[model samples]
Target: MSRVFEKRYALSRRALLRSVGGLGALTAMPLLSHEAFAQPVFRVYPFQLGVAAGDPQPDGFVIWTRLAPEPLDLGYGMPSEPVEVKWEVAADAGFRTVARSGTAVARPELGHSVHVEVAGLEPARPYWYRFTAGKERSLYGRARTTPLAGTDLQRVRFGVAGCQHYEQGYFTAYRKLAAEPDLDFVFCYGDYIYEYRGERLANGGTGPIETIRQHNEGEIYSLDDYRRRYAQYKMDADLQAAHAAAAWFTTWDDHEIDNNWVGDIDQDGTPAEVFRLRRQAAAQAYFENMPLRARSFPIGPSVQLYRRASYGRLLDLNLLDTRQYRTDQPCGDEWAATCAGVAAREAQVLGAAQEKWLLDSLSGSRARWKVLAQQIMMMDLDRAPGKAVGYNLDSWAGYAQPRDRLLRQIRDRRIENAIVITGDEHQNFAGELHLTGATPGPRPIASEFVVTSISSGGNGQDQRPDMIEIQRANPQLKFNNAQRGYMICDVTPERWESEFKVLDKVSDREGALSTRTKLAVAADDARVVSA
Candidate 1:
């Protein structure tokens, strides 16, 4: 049958689906032919990979799901046909009162994934949602719209985490995060899954990181590999629980496509054309797996990820896309370089366009807190302890000109309460952003808290020796912790506070999560203060 005919093969319920009651009444709809509503050629639950929702506005949010019956199979054990998926949002979990409901086509071309943007609902209210594909019902998900864009709000809470390597350990930190009922949303800062082909990595210098599970086989070059990998991660109960507990806001760094990849360039040195194909495949899988809004829908290796999420009058979040527009690491990734190559002014992280967008957003924001939810460490951390300093070129420290430009804009524009939430260092840090990049006694233009990874590295210590050295050399630094877990931010009208929540260990499931330290920055002041 033709593509259009195959689409028409679905149960005829256009008029029935326009009403809320018709959604639940769809249980009896059947395929006209055996090939109409195709199923995987195996015994597996279609919703094994789980469901999620993200990018919530005051009126709506996006709900996501993929039909992966046999998750690891080359075809993800899903038939090569479109399936009808119905989603209903209710004010309560019991489905007694449906607020908004709709049906979406889970197409084979998009890996059988569904993204339904539920709209016209009440603002700042909690809603429960679930999907039904044929007879299989997905786990219900909890989501909330942001407060009306201009409402005078007092407080908001959220958790930030990323860099979860599947083999490193279990997602116990996510379990801890899922239990936090007060969180408005979760901010995932890149490296959600590693693309390595099961290469054994030493967790830290010389020490072997304990493994809980390993990757399927080789490096993921095709769509199937990435899909299988994502399905494997979603199958974890902790991650699923996290998704079920609240909505999520996410952005990608190096590992989503390839390590240290900038723009169209892949780190493995594949030709740009071939790498673009790989990138497109990776993006397809990412969109298939992530609970992102339609604005970030992938199209031939590109996706518009940088957008604003406003939460009433209390906060406006400018989620950035660091990897997509960044310059390749000046002196190669993950190394210290003091050469002139690092000093060149042409290096751009946000490209020219996104930088403008950010500055404009910052200037126009009327909220009490302006938060930049981005990836990477923004401080100029010196790796060398002497007069001639060496810096890591992989982070914002490498793109000094742009970093300085951004800080200057923050200062010149007088952006108040400009707080940056970050990750990808695998270690916690509380620091200030200074124009001169001198840590000691320099008044900060802005403040940032770099949240660590969930399980990217193995268990870490309370502090690293080099961090102490760096701290001594730089006084703007306030707190540092090397551990596995997430960071929680409490944003109020008058002040913003962050708790460095830590897991004692990720190498084993027994590690307890604790608040290692707390820090605060007043709304009027740009300096980080210990709470």
Candidate 2:
């Protein structure tokens, strides 16, 4: 069966607010007529999922949204029809006077996603924005630019979250994060969407626990499959609310396609060439659904996912790409010398281009703090100290050479106040990073705070005995908690504090949230102190 016809797909009632009469038909709809346009029934796009602004510079930030009207193809098909989208940024919530306003068009070729890179704005100031298409308008989204160079920012609060498996539970975590009005923005560290065909639980189940759309009848190996999955995930209300609540900076990890997939390797060691078409499809869908700049658009099986963002004089965040340019998975006994060899100098995690970019950016950065916004833990997370190896070899530990080199650069160049915010493992961890083999041997060079997952594995799972033993052996690891929640990081000129907030219960949809732990790093020292 054809991909499109695999399911009797129909746009939801909420998606039909904007008629399918093309731009002309939109005007004819009672809700989109001239009078309606004058007083538009401003409703956010349901499947646009989330609204986010990112890559904030002194001048501007990119605002994004996807149009999901009926006859779904009308919004993403070729010919690239122009759909007028009006956007405004304001100092206040009511939009009494606009700070910035412009007209943009959502082109069909890019899945009708609109990316408005607004400029001519003041730095270190908060702004509220919204978008309108015909009679349909998105919710007000908040974003801000980095402060001016050398300006003292007393505080910067941001939310960190990842691994939101839609079927596991509702995006209640996001709902709570959105309610926190003090947040400047959100940092999503990958696994935003899982590519599994259905929920695979410890107890055998053949379908998703909860889903907006049916899963792919089989494994997703096509662009259409990925696109449809994105659409399904976006239909979640909580995810949409969070996106509307704040601007987001994002990166992707393995589940965006398959677990542990690097470059083009299959579970059976099949070359990426065999799955080239599927990989291309996944990359394209990822680009269409993300609030990424044009430069990161997918060309084929690859997309440039690494870049830098500045937060005024306070911080420079370098988001890394650990998937695309990585070496193959390691081989040998889980904890043997053979496995360690796989992490040799030839092994790579950041790829050549990304490594050079990261090194140069870190060395040249003038911000008070250099933040590495990466997908996995940067600290050494050996499941077993000297004997047992970790279960997964796709993380930084697997690319030991690249990890050491990056840490060496930070130490050699005297990159002060370096910090890494990461996500991926379904656990929260706080650690002080030390460059073991550098000239300044075994000295603390950076700090890393890893956020837990959203709803991948519930919070009630029994603790793993191996992990418990591993923690007892690794003194560098300050804190560890297996839970379902997010992290909140507050940065300032004097200190950066992080709180590991966990949901009271992931088994229940309306769970409460509490702080699992807290860690702080002082600007004068690169060490992590308990808060």
Candidate 3:
């Protein structure tokens, strides 16, 4: 569907759907055969993969469900043809007041997945949704629209979480996230699934970690492989519950395709041409599973995942694609001292176009808070604990010049309340941001809150000796924790409060969650402090 038609349809849908209730079943599109209108019979429940909603706008949000009668089977245990799936939106949980009802075709080309860009919803309100295929019914889901553009919001709450390796541990953190009652949305930072077959050495440095479970037979590369991998992850009940509980704002990092992949360059040095094919498959599989809008559909190896979402005059969320447009990681992409490559003027993390877009958006945004919901830590952290200085070349520290330029621009442009939420570190960090080359003396221009992994690092400790040494070395860091958990942020007009919710263990299914730390940044100040 073209954008022009979509807008027109959305404008008219509000009135059309008002009279649609109890008006009998709508006919299927004429392009299909008579059998398209017939009810399907399923041996297994088709909605085993569950339901989800994401990328909410003021008027509506996207609702998604894949028809997988047997998710583990090849082809998702569905016919190699299109199937009509029924969907409904209601104002109440019991679906007493139907808001919209329609039929969507689940096409085989997209692995029988359904992505319906629901429109005509009331702004800043909650809506209940569900799906039906034949005699099977999907689990009910709740989605909400943001406030109208420029609407003054007093407060908003959300969660930041990512990095769930299926083999490492159970998705207990996700279950905790799903139970958050007042979240407006969940910003999923990345590493939704690990590409490796099973538990491997942490960053290929630490010794091989034990696994509570196991991934499929091999590392995924082909389209079928990627699809099956996503199916396996989505089959988790905890993950499914999180998706159903709230709308999601998602973007992928390195593990979505390959570990430490740089643009078209694969980590193992696969040729760009060959790796592009792998990236194509990975991108398609990502879109098929994500509740993204039509505009984010993959074209070859590229998808426009860098976009902006505004929540009235309160927040401007710029979800960035750091992995897709980045130059190769400098200094061999490992923990090392800053090298000449790190200072190269040509090095890019957001690329030329994306960086310009981000700067321009930040400059023009009228929102009270400007958020960069992205992958990778932006703060230049010294990873080494002692006399020898080291940094992760895959992070912003790898491109020191670029990092300095971005921070300098933030300072020069006077972008107030600039906050960054990052993923992929598997360890929580609350840090103050400064120019990499600056002679820093507590003059931070921004703040960053890095959420830990969902279950990637197994059962992590509350604190480690090495981490203590590192934290002592970097005084700019306000707090750090090595645990499996996520972060919850509560934003108001005056202050932004962040709470680190940590789990004792993810290797086991039952562990209590606790708040490890709580920090806040005043609207006029960039430093993070105890709340």
CA-RMSD of model 2: 7.0
Q: Could you give candidate 3's per-residue lDDT for residues 98-152 as a string of tens digits? A: 9988877776678878888788889999999999877779989999899999899
lDDT score for candidate 3 against the true structure = 0.85
Best by lDDT: 3
What lDDT tens digits, residue by residue, belong to model 2 across residues 1-531? Answer: 222211123222232344322321111122333321112122333225556676666776778876664323323222234345677888888998798886555555556676776778998777888887656567787877776767766778899999987666667788888898678778899998888766444431554354423343456677667766787777677787787777788889988878777777756556668766777888878887876666776777888889887766787889888888877767632432235565577888888888899989998988888999988777766665567545345567666788888888888889999999888888888888875323322357888898888887655332455667777766677788887889998888999999988886665668888887789999958777887
TM-score of each: 0.91, 0.84, 0.92
The residue pairs found clashing in candidate 2 are 146-312, 147-312
Instruction: Rank all candidate structures by their TM-score, best first, as comma-separated numbers.
Output: 3, 1, 2
Evaluate all candidate structures by whole-model CA lDDT and list the values in order.
0.82, 0.71, 0.85
The global Cα lDDT (0 to 1) of model 1 is: 0.82
Query: lDDT-based ranking, best first?
Result: 3, 1, 2
lDDT value, residue 277 of candidate 1: 95
TM-score: which candidate is best? 3
Q: Clash totals for all models, in order?
A: 0, 2, 0
Q: TM-score: which is higher, 1 or 2?
A: 1
lDDT of 1 by residue, 367-458 (tens): 99999999988888787776567787888888888989999899888887899888988999998888655545545788989998888877
In model 1, where do residues sit more than 4 Å from their true spots?
1-42, 199-210, 438-442
